[model samples]
Target: MSAWEQFITYVSQNGFYIWTEFYRHFLMAAYGVLFASIISIPIGILIARYGKLSGFVMTLGSIIQTIPVLGFMAITMVVMGLGTTTVVVTVFFYSLLPIIQNTYVGIIGVDRTIKEAAYASGMTQFQLLLKVELPLAVSVIMAGIRTALVVGIGVVAIGTFVGAGGLGAIIVRGTNATDGTAIILAGAVPTALMAIVADLIMGKIERMLNPVSN
Candidate 1:
């Protein structure tokens, strides 16, 4: 059989297992990015509110981004032990830079005219941010989230190394087997599809939220 045929056979034979890993992988990535967003968005807003902190915050995010994924996982695994949690933590840190950067850019990108008008209309600082700035900036913030999620999906694949039960484990299994090209592809194809689907869905949402699009 051709490589493609073999890949199809492998996928068909292990559909349930593949799907289980896919679900696990998706959860690990999603949870990581979700947690990161909860924290990073607020941090992004604070730094935007106080410009003095932007540079420092950006620099800190950059430093975290520089950490080797495997090394980070190893460190976390030692502390947390082998599990999905370790992978989620790694994905969370990896997700921080894009979300925070986009959020900061989005908030500051709100128009000066609008801000003044909001202030003139008796909107308090909090109200202005809530009512005007955030609405306008939402698309950009979503763009950051989209980027983080796409990256997080890839990061979660490495979780298999820590026994996190992601598609990466499937790929690894193939690698450990003889004549495992199809097996490797069984995992690779789904990972690619997940990233592509996530990007398309989130990209659509980001565009739809843009006031420019509306």
Candidate 2:
């Protein structure tokens, strides 16, 4: 086939995969972030609230990071068996460190003077947290979340190795078929698009939710 005809043929054949799996991969990445956030945010808040726990939290997250992804997945599969649960949980755990670290840093980085002023103004602890501390810390927390999301997107794409299908299925197919460009585009394009869109959306949300200071 001529190059133009080959291009047309590839587009016709593969466009469905792109459209169908793009959001699937996006959701997989999102699932990783959501599950990780559920576990990490509360713990990070507690760690920041108590100096004693900060060391413990950091140590644990760091230790988890040291474990290789393939090893962790194999262990999880052996213990829990195959399928979505194992893949999701593995991706979730992989995503936790960034969220927890970022949250702790963000909360701790709040200006002490602002905190004091809020307290002196008769604002309750809850109010101070809601109106002052969280708003200021949002940027940092979002940065952490952004990092976790990017990492999770990359990792979860490999979950096809465990029977969970996403865009990774396309990648695996291309690899086995020896179609180099197909695998690269199939995997890289959707992932890159997801990361860009997610970061942009989160950036807007952070700006909107965070209070502006003069």
Candidate 3:
């Protein structure tokens, strides 16, 4: 068979497994990231607004990030046991730094004049944050979310090692067998594609939310 024919055959044969597993992992990772985003964004905004102890939170998140993926997986498995729950928790922990930092930066980066104008217009603190700060900072927050998504997609592959059974199953099994490069490629290629698609979608959203021109 030609390369195209082989590719088509592979997709035809394994498409269901690939698509189902991919969607499961994607949703799991997205849930973790969503939780992280919800918790971190407001905290980030507060830190930025108060200008206090941002350094500490960033440092804590950095330490969390420095833990190796395999080590984290092993540790989580021991603590939480082998399941999707452990994996989701792990991904959640991993996603916090980027989201928090981005939220802080985005909100803080809003133009001072715009904030002043809101105050002049007699907007309450809540009104200003909801209407002006969040809108202006949305692009930055989305950028963080995009970064978390890409990173989570990569990291959550470790889930399969503990029997969570997503696309990572192919990758972990492939690595174990030593000659399963095709399986590895099957898992990895879709992840890269997903990341690219996610980036494009988020980029469009970011542009839509951006208050500044160009």
Candidate 4:
């Protein structure tokens, strides 16, 4: 049978298991991105405000990003041990740089004239940020989030190496089998589809949030 045919046959016989793995994979990515956003956005805002700290922060993030995913996971496994916790943490680390850098850029990239106008109108610093800067920067920030999320989805597959349980498990199973191309596709194709769907959804949101440019 062809790979596609084999995939269909496998799914028909193992639909429940496949679905469960898909859900787990999604959960890992979602949780990782969620926490990364929570942590990174605030730090981004702080660095943007300070100005002097941007280089240091960006350098740190760059260093973290340079580490191979497997190497990072190996280090994390030592500290956190094997499980979903380590997987989620690893994903969170991987997702942080893009979000932080984007948030910083977006906030700082707001037009100086607009900021002056807001200040002249007697808006407080906090109000200025919430009302003016963030609104204007929402599109850029969303783009960063979209990037991180798509990357996170792919990274979650690596969790299988540590027994965290995801579609990667299926891919690994296929790799170990004699005729496993079909099985690997069963995991990979869905992952790619998920990333595409996420990107489209985030794109819509970014467009909606973006201010109408002149």
Candidate 5:
């Protein structure tokens, strides 16, 4: 049989297994980004308030990004050991740069005149952030999340290396089998589709949040 026929056969036989792996893969990516967002968003807001700190924080995030994926995963694994926990931690580290950078840019990009107007209207700094700046900046912040999530989805595939199951696990299994091209496709096709679906959904949400959207 051709590879396509084999792929369909494998998928039909293991539909439940594939679905479980797909769900696991998505949860790893989502959790990693979710945890990062809780911290990075606050850090971004702080650095935006302190212009001098922006340079240092951004530099730190960039430095993290520069680390090779396998190398970074090894480092995290040493501390956390194998399985999904390590992968989630690795994903968190990998996801920081885009979210932090975007949040900083979005906050600072708010118009100076609008900020001034808020002050004139007797708004406290915190009130201004809540009522003025954040509302305007949310779209750009969402853009950061959009970027982080897409990248995170890709990164989670590497989680298989640490014994964290995902679609990657299926691909790895196929690599050891004779005539495993179909098995590899069974894993790979879902991963690509998952990423594409995620990107499309996030893109729509980002555009909706954009203040200038008609």
Candidate 6:
């Protein structure tokens, strides 16, 4: 039979297993991005408010981003050991740069005239940030999140190497077996779909957050 036929047969027999792996994969990426956002958005706000820290913080994120994924994972393994924790931590670290950088840029990029008006109205620093800056920067921040989410989805596949249990496990298993192309497809196709779906969803959110007057 053909590879396609084999794939069909495999899925027919192993649908439950594939679904479980896909769920785990989705969770890995979702939790990672979620945690990163919680941490990074506030840091971004701080960086924007204190211009002196912007360069140092951005540089730190860039340095982390430059680390090879495998090398970072290896280092994390030493500290975190193998499993979901390591995978989640790795994904979280990878997701940080874009989110934080975009948030900082978006906030600082707000028109100076608008900022002055807010200041002239006696808005406190917290008030200006919450009412003026964050609202205006929502679209940019969402764009960063969308990018990070898609990237995290792809990265989560690497989790299988450390026994974190995602679709990557399927890919790894397939590579280890004879006539495993079908098995690899079982994992690969779903991962691609996940990324596409996440991108589309995030695109809608980004558009929704953008000011209609703009």
In order, candidate lDDTs are: 0.95, 0.78, 0.85, 0.91, 0.90, 0.93
**Where does model 1 exceed 4 Å of error?**
none
What is the C-alpha lDDT profile of model 2 across 42-96, one tens digit per residue? 8887888897998888888889889887778788888768766667778788888
lDDT string for model 4 (146-207, tens) is 99999999899999998898999999999999999888988888888888999999989988
RMSD values for the candidates in order, in angstroms, are: 0.6, 2.5, 2.0, 1.3, 0.9, 1.2
lDDT of 5 by residue, 9-57 (tens): 9999999999999999999999999999998988999999999998999
- Model 5: weakest 10-residue lDDT segment is 205-214
List pairs with backbone clashes in candidate 3: none
Give the winner by lDDT: 1
Candidate 6 wrongly placed segments (more than 4 Å): none
Q: Top model by TM-score, which number?
A: 1
lDDT of 1 by residue, 1-214 (tens): 9989999999999999999999999999999999999999999999999999999999999998888899999999999999999999999999999999999999999989999999999999999989999999999999999999999999999998999989999999999999899999999999999999999999999999999989
Judged by lDDT relative to the true structure, which candidate is superior, 3 or 5?
Answer: 5
Candidate with the larger TM-score of 1 and 3: 1
lDDT of 3 at 126: 94
TM-score of each: 0.99, 0.87, 0.91, 0.97, 0.98, 0.96
Predicted candidate 6 versus true structure: per-residue lDDT over 1-214, tens digit per residue: 9999999999999999999999999999999999999999999999998999989998999999999887888899999999998989999999999999999989998999999999999999889998999999999999999999999998889988888989999999899989999999999999999999999999999998987535
Output the worst ten-in-a-row residue range by lDDT, candidate 3.
Answer: 1-10
lDDT of 6: 0.93
Rate residue 214 of model 5 by lDDT. Answer: 44
TM-score of 4: 0.97
* Cα lDDT, model 3, residue 209: 74
